[model samples]
Target: MENKNLVDDCLFCKIIRGEVPSYTVFENDDVKAFLDISQVNPGHTLMIPKKHITNLFDYTKEDVQRYLQYIPEIANAIKKAFPNVTGMNITTNNGKSANQVVMHSHIHFIPRFKGDGLKLMTRNNADQYDEAKYNEVADKIKAQF
Candidate 1:
């Protein structure tokens, strides 16, 4: 049976179906891990679900469980494959505003070393939030539950 979630023209879906070439590192029935063509680092990798869900907001409960289950194992394999890797960043961009180029949901495993020149985030407004602001934000998110 066809997986209704698979998008016909999605890049990651093409990679998943072997219609596009990729430097695939690992793959199973549920997910595929491959080298990011735009190597932010030497061992930069992308782990994506076989299903073509757009982003985290679209994942079902079972999708989350199956997708996350392979992260630890794949991360360890990446670390082991690269002896110089000191640390790692596992990130997923949720939408176009979040820098998601492709529509498929993917987790990035970026290996980090001291002074790799990659700046993942900056704290420009570290002191902007006070207790009241913090509580207001927290309460808004908590109310959703």
Candidate 2:
């Protein structure tokens, strides 16, 4: 049974409706932020718009504005929740190709400490550098600045 009122079985919608359970931290009229079941660290959190959208790229201007309006407070909540955190990283996964398991627009705030589990490595190879592409990317980013 497809419940049109529920955005076609959205996990976040079920969470908001209390039809499912989650370790939620904050919620308002238009947004909600919750603890990740698979925590990347002590304060890894997922924030989302109350309304359904496949991802951030698909949000309307109103939805975008509404979601951003609440971010600072939500971030502050994370800061308080993870009192020992040294730094924070905010990220969003867009599509299945981008690793988004749930079809909802969400921002993840992952806090990090010195020598924590968020280490990264890069392969040094021919695919790592491209000169023509670098200039084009810099030109595009410069325009934004």
lDDT tens digits, residue span 11-120, model 2: 88888777889888888877788998888888788997777878987877877887778777877888887777788888888999888999888888888877797864
Candidate 1, which ten residues in sequence have the lowest lDDT sum? 118-127
Model 1, 19-41: lDDT tens digits are 89999999998999999999999
- Which predicted model would earn the best lDDT? 1
In candidate 2, position 36 carries an lDDT of 89
Compute each candidate's TM-score over C-alphas.
0.94, 0.80
Q: Which one wins on TM-score?
A: 1
Regions of candidate 2 where Cα sits further than 4 Å from its true position: 1-5, 120-131, 135-145
